[model samples]
Target: MSHVSSICLRNSAFSLLVSVFILMLTACGDLRESKVDGYGLPVVQIEMNSETLGLLLGQVTSKRPVAAEVKMQGDVKMKCEVSFAGQSSLNDYRKSLNLRACKNHPSEQTRFRLAAQNRDKTTNRAILAYEMFARTGMTVPTTELVSAYVNHDFLGVYLLTEPISSEYFHRRGIRVADIYQSKFGNAGFRKEFSSNLSEAFDYEGDGKDNYAALQGVYKTLWDNLSDEEFERRIEMQIDVDNFMSYMATAVYTAHWDGFDNNYFMALDKTKRKLIVAPWDLDRVWEKAFEFNPADFLSRNQLLFRMMTISSFRKVFASKLDLLLENFPVEVQLSNLEMKKAHSQSALAMDKVNGPDLEASFDGFEEQIKVWNEKIRTFRNTIAE
Candidate 1:
């Protein structure tokens, strides 16, 4: 009787253990499956010290970068600084992120930008703008979609890009020291030059603030001189081709934020020339496309000054026409659709109620139709 009872008890215990194992397996399977759609894109899993992250997020003015454990693709782990980035984006429904190497990662290879793309609604503008700029023979940041998780909380699909910093220059073998970022200010050349707001034009890299070169260039542009003198001096100070190409892209993309607010000037001090670069293309392909391109540059004085020069105006007009003729809108839209397809599931799962990414794509398609018609009208106006 005792042996039979013991055998029954043992069998019952085994069944219970089997049931538990099956339950555990099912739970693990769900966890793995939930994040499966997140494949194809790099998964940036951030392990944040809750207190440190809280402090970073709660700060009003002083944004102290906090350390986090960053694991990419479930393999590479590095210590990185996580900080809130952008002006309006900081106050927006979704805030952008700036990551830099705090420790362990290489100093010259560790900064990355993750844009919120809140205003963009479509989340495609940044990528489209960057690609368009790159197509115009400009050195722009490499961008991709990333599924970001902070302490197991899904932050949804983010536009992960290489920040235009010293690291960016190093990768391209460009020796640039004095890098200044543009910010909110009067779009006049003199105003931009004299802007003392730390947020207006920030010095990048660990180099000494060398404003002498930039100031000298500003003085040349500031002076009222003969068209020939102005053209020659401006060309000497800037990469005219790059500037024109940037302008053309901006006009084509209808990037209202491009000219004055969202750009960086990288000075090759030895060459004494500035390379204009694009940034923050989240506000493109909208109302500007419907309005006059000339009207869009209401505050950008440099371009206004250049418009007065017939020779420069002709070249600029030609560049705009060429970009309009060659811009691959269809291909770019296709690429955008592909990216949205890849990132849709993860973005839909965003905890912060990030906009309906799929619906935004539809809106983007409609905007493109409007943009095409407006562009044709602009071309016609310019022709006449």
Candidate 2:
């Protein structure tokens, strides 16, 4: 809750390969071109609720596929692609086929939708939350709120978005140990993160480090595996470390589905290579919302506890400052807003998690807007 300045440059960017994207792209041809001029990238347009714009634009990536966004409300809605084309994502079908995916969008785009039910409305509250966050100057993708209608039925709001490549750092071709050594040779991850950020901007995770691969590292350290397996195990183990570090940042940012955000790619912006980038953030925020409401609560899971404890924090502390700063305002705010919304949803879910989910989604739309405006006002009041 306290504005964490030191965490502005928490130094936690890296590459992660994504299974979903790879799977989808395997067949090829489903890219959506965007209207934006500066960057000639393709964007995925989904129906977005203006209220949750920040939530919609978590982090944009500089993938081979660029992103553009549009938001809809009123009678407008979005469509999804059921089939694959070249390397297109679902949004491609929306534009090519001229379909609405938000509500009344065909079943191919949205499986959860019902005849009279507009399941994909992007509530006004959600849009506001997203907008407020974008203004914060975090690295969020472009956003838009779209309208929805099914078979001529009116569905309220939806979101348009540009997806960032989940793997940001690995694509950059930098090693974690190299990054750590370059910044703070002797220091551990957390300490070096603080030191490096205090000096300047640094958000790359070391490629040499892998926590998940710790098992593999142990295998190598103890000489228990075959050569090829050892190499593969070490590689995966390094990623585990990277994943854990990335997850640690998520706790601070309160992102979810970030596990799915894991994708890495490298691009040569200039002659020099950059670190892996466009990390998909998950668990945007449950903590802030949990802190907000009187009736909200979650079971204290041990793994989560371990994630937030000092030991975890110590490992993640260094990257904390830079990551927050590096993160776009919308990305940060969306998580904050989502936390509250999720809590409220949780409360409602205790009543019922499924069926009639639209009402619950709509109810929180306004909350997102209010939350966003408040942040904007606070930032404006600051002596920036």
Best by TM-score: 1
Residue pairs of candidate 1 with colliding backbone atoms = none
Could you give candidate 1's per-residue lDDT for residues 1-384 as a string of tens digits? 344334434553222212222333323222222343354567876665535544554442354677877766455778888777777765455567778874554434688877767777656678877877877788998887787766554566678888888778778877887788887753335454554435457777565776655676667767767888988888888887777778777877888777777888888756668888888888787664356666755456777787677766666677767766666557656777787777666666765434566677777777766776676676666531
In model 1, the runs with Cα more than 4 Å from the true position are 1-40, 102-108, 187-200, 205-208, 351-355, 380-384
Give one digit per residue, the lDDT tens place, for model 2 in 197-311: 3232222334533222222233343454554554454343344234334433433333332322332322223322222222322123323434321111111121232333344
List runs of model 2 lying over 4 Å from the truth: 1-140, 149-153, 164-248, 256-283, 286-315, 322-384
Error of 1 at 201 (Å): 2.0
Give the worst 10-residue stretch by lDDT in candidate 1: 13-22
Q: Pick the candidate with the highest lDDT.
A: 1
In the order shown, the candidates' Cα RMSDs to the true structure are 11.5, 18.8
Model 2 RMSD in Å is 18.8
What is the TM-score (0 to 1) of candidate 1? 0.81
